[model samples]
Target chain A: MRELLERKLVFVTGKGGVGKSTIAASLALLAAQQGKRTLVGEIDAKGNLADFFETGPTAFKERELAPNLWGMSMDTEESLKEYLSLQLKIPLLAKVGVLARTFDFVANAAPGVKEILTVGKFLWEVREGHYDLVVVDAVASGHITGQLAAPQAIQELVQVGMVRDQTDWMIEILGDHDQTGAVIVAAPEEMPVNETLELAARLREETVVELAAVVANRVLPELFGRGEEEVFEALAADDRTPSPADLLGAAVGGPVRPILDGAQLAVTLRRTRGVHLARLRDELPTGTPLLYVPYLFQRSHGARATRQVAEHLAEELGY
Target chain B: MAARQRTASAGSVEQLLAAKEIVIHCGSGGVGKTTTAAAVAAMAAVHLGGKVLVLTVDPAKRLANALGLEAFGNVETQVPRQAFLDAGAEPRGELWAAMLDTKESWDDLVRRHAPDAGTRDAILANPLYKNITGRFVQSHDYIAMERLYEIHASGRFDLIVVDTPPTRNAIDFLEAPERMADFFSSRLLRWLTVPARSRVLSMASKPFYSVADRILGSKFLEDIAEFFLLFQTMYKGFVIRAEAVARTLADHRTTFVVVSTLESAPVREAEFFIDALDDRGLHLGAVVLNKVLPPWFLDEGTTATAKAMVADAVSLAKVLPEELGSPDQVGRVLREVGESFLNFQVVANREAEMRAELSAAPEVVASVPYFDHDITDLAGLLQLGEQIWR
Candidate 1:
């Protein structure tokens, strides 16, 4: 996992709501804590990392969120402008009213253009060698694959020019096993884990990127052991109510009903979660390390909590 | 309990289903949007007695599995009647499921909108068309919505539940028609097509063509010229259909149901969507907060009793070996369960607070407690439906 972190560019993606953004933030924080300058690029204009960092929404330009951690929210429109002006050498085309009007049409006509621009910009950071690591909080699995495969796809279509030359560089960096890798985030549940495996297969087939690590979020703790399982089964078979004689023998006090119900719910939830965990382990490719992050029951994932997650990952990853 | 009361009154998901013809479930990924859509479709068919079609543009196949469909296709397929019955649903109306095939839909749209067979065939065979239709950013979203409008107009299903892709793509699904309209009306295509229209215009645009050919290759310019001419002939119909789709989306019967979770990121994404939908004047009726932790039984009156039980249970566990099992194991299990109940309360309260804050928004927010397992079967979906309507 640490070796996975050593890649110059780490693209993080998974099924939505699996805490991909949080995992990216945690990984970035951990890398930074290891004395590496890390830049985490968020794909949407709305910055989720801002909340995790407990800062204002990340600006379009990169800004330091922590000592060695920097964050930037990638707006496709802004990236298009930047790409046109800087990479394509058409500084005024992206600004002119008429051409800008055409920009939308062109962008729509070429779907991966925006994706290419976003990914190109991220790869550009890696090319600049300004940071030790570039972590991208990517879009959901299917689209993220499109983004990762964009350079090669476009290169195959376009035969010549600066765009081709630039994509060549992207292909080189992305295909370099030691330089680029992707970390997939998944929950312990079935669909997310299944999607994670699917994404891994797609990445292996379509892109030149490596499947680095799988981070399973919200893994519930074990609440029942072998003996306890038998005990719970026996309890379930018996009537829930205690006999009058038994109540008198114990001389117990307080409201027992709620506690008993809570215990039952807890045991059921834990037992079910264990099944999912087992499936995840069984389905995942053998020898591919899967890191489990315990469920953190909190109201908000503010900077403090994000750092706490980072600490947990750091410990598990042996950073 | 108080929070649940407010959410129940803010807007009933059941009422939203009964009232609306189209229920669009838009949210970020992994928030149970697919499950919510499937459950809503099932509920509408069984409880509301309306024929329903649930379409998912998400590339993931979870919806098919969630609906317990043995097979799913680009075309709508009826969910097995036996599965619905097994789930204890008295489904009076039909439930159909489909996954979007962007390429197929794009091809169909071009064929329908084209002026003639030759033009349509030419457009279909164009390499640029193939690449653009398949790779374009909003093409998938746009085509899904186009197909949706077509299906809705056919009057086959009384209710259409859409489980959209991730946030950006879902937003694109809403705005795609407008983008299509803009593209059809843009000046660049008109200029590009001028060379193919008239010999005089071709001569007049020779310098422009020469420059473009020099930069992009003569073959590329020829391909563009051919594509533009074919596209120009069909532009009117395309614009009209795009505008019609936009109008259909804004229809009062069309309601956007945002599915989110208690996480700040998802909640924030939901807020962004709600605000965007409001700006567009689209009706937003319900916000489904999926996988919320259930509240504990402890409240002000019960807290003292719960604490007393914890103490009593711990003491009784220490002496339980004499009566039942090993004292150490019994004591450990009792203490862990007792302490874990408190932890559950804390998690539940935090989630409740977040739900309360979100409920203050204009849309009705309904919550479904985090299930013990993934809801990938019809019975599980029915269970979620009951919770949503509960």
Candidate 2:
């Protein structure tokens, strides 16, 4: 199987609030850190992606995010404009500008035009070799299949047109597993993990893209190893004389019960998600690479979290 | 774990559930929105005497099984009395559950609103109708609200709690009814459906079609126009229904509850939703904060103690009796425990900041602490509900 970064174009999607954009930014950061020239694009302009890079807002035009990484936000209108001008070779800028704007309006109402335009821009970057990797922070999990299949849907809906001609190549790029793959970012919870597994099957069955890998994000670290939990229990026991809690309380000169209770909460939280992790692993396709990103207890999701997640991804990939 | 029975008093979620005829829960996905909605409905059924219905969208099958039902669909299924009894609750009112089937609901709307059977069947059979109804972003929002309106008018349930689908924009669900009305009555629809020859002959629309025709294909354009022309027969019915749904949303008897975790994204969305509700004069009943870390994690003394334990782990380990483990192993355990607390404290502090920054909260702001386990049964939901009840 090809490595995730080796794929020319990767679309990352997950259920909302599952840290989909963070994983996309981190994966792109990791790719750039590994010396690949990468383009990271966000499909929505909610502007959170800029927060991930801790940079000023990214516009429709590409801007340098790091030495090897560039970023942009997808504007379907702008994408349509570019596609029209480039495809038609129309010299009249003002006229074609109005024409494209009107067409963009129709695209909004048309079944698949807007979706195709969004996906087409990223594929264009790959086909033109503008970057070694194009990372798309695509729409959330439930909407990705519609986005991925937009090109073919447009092709079928429009029998003869310039749009029809353009879709033929887009479909080829998307169909080639070596050139394009999708990564699912999921947390170890019932809904996200289930969505990831379902998306994996749907990607193969409903869309042209292949599942590159499954990223298990925000996985809790195990707090105890082997018999250490027994020691923790013994220390926390209320009946014991001069219990570890008491000694620790005396030593620290404050109550230790809450600290111990916090640890217990951590243990239980990890244990609960552990069931979900096991289910996710067992149910995923056998050869699919499952990567885990440790949950970061950070102040905010900005540049720092992005870098930290990149480091974890690097280590998980056997860097 | 025993759930504490907090005061279910005047300003609690309990009061809102009892008073309001309709409560709609909205939030970003994966923030326990469905669970929060179900839990509150369970409490309403248990504490307040009336028929209560929870209309959920795309619930996990385990949730149905937890309610002691195999599954349910567009039709409301009454949760068995035995299920509540097993959950240790002698319910005062009947509890019912239903999942939204968007396609079925849309078909029903057509059947009800269409002028006659011929027009209804023609509209339903249109290929573009199927495509638009299924793939249109606004259709789900419209259908969900439409179904709610239908059920609310039926007066079968004393209280109805709805879990809205996750919409990318903050106000899309709220604006859905008006948008649907505007769409059917818009100039775009009229222009698109203009007779094909007249469309070409009109000097104003010639450029539009010449451009649209090449890109979309003449056949596809004709199909869309034909479909819209068929739909135009029921425009009055749709417009009237949309107005009724919008009125229901803004009615004093209806209220909106925004559920979110203290995570930044959901909080941002929650605030947006709250503001939108306030702007529209819709009652913002309560804000339910789910999966909040316990306040003990923020105790000043606990922070200092966790730090001291991590910094002086070697000495702290030696103070313990030796039967548990070797001193080195004890030290390792001590360090891990201390570090884990410190790690969680970072998140806990952030949560505190998010909670603090949450301004303009209504009179009833409730917080549910993080549960280590998923709420799978009615008892578990009731347990969760009690935490936020007051």
* Candidate of highest lDDT: 2
Model 1 DockQ, alpha carbons vs. true complex: 0.42
lDDT of 2 by residue, B1-390 (tens): 122233345377787777799999998778888888888888899999799999997657877877889998899999999999998999999999999988899899889888899999999988767667877757888898999999999999999999898877767888999988988898877887885426445887777677777777788788777887888888999999999999999998998888889999888888888888889988988888889998988888888988988888888888788897898888888888889988999999898887765534666778999998887888898899898786
Look at candidate 2 and give me any clashing residue pairs: none
Runs off by more than 4 Å, candidate 1? A80-105, A224-253, B1-12, B59-62, B65-68, B188-229, B301-316, B319-321, B361-365
Q: Can you tell me which runs of candidate 2 are displaced by over 4 Å? A: A90-92, A95-101, B1-10, B197-200
Query: Candidates' TM-scores?
Result: 0.89, 0.96
Across A126-155, the per-residue lDDT of candidate 2 in tens digits comes to 999999999999999988999999998887
lDDT tens per residue, model 1, B1-390: 234445334557777778889888888777888788888888888888767998887655666776777668789999988889888877988899988888888898988999999999999998788777877657777887898899999898899998875646447779989988887787776776665665465565565455444333445445556776777788899899999999999999999988888777777678778888989999988888988865554364445544554566556655433434565555555555566667677677776666776666554667798786667788888888888874
Clashing pairs in 1: A16-B29, A16-B30, A111-B136, A111-B137
Question: What is candidate 2's CA lDDT for residue A108?
Answer: 57
* Number of the predicted model whose DockQ against the real structure is largest: 2
Per prediction, the TM-score for chain B is 0.85, 0.96
Name the lDDT value of residue B33 in candidate 1. Answer: 83
Interface RMSD of each: 4.1, 1.6
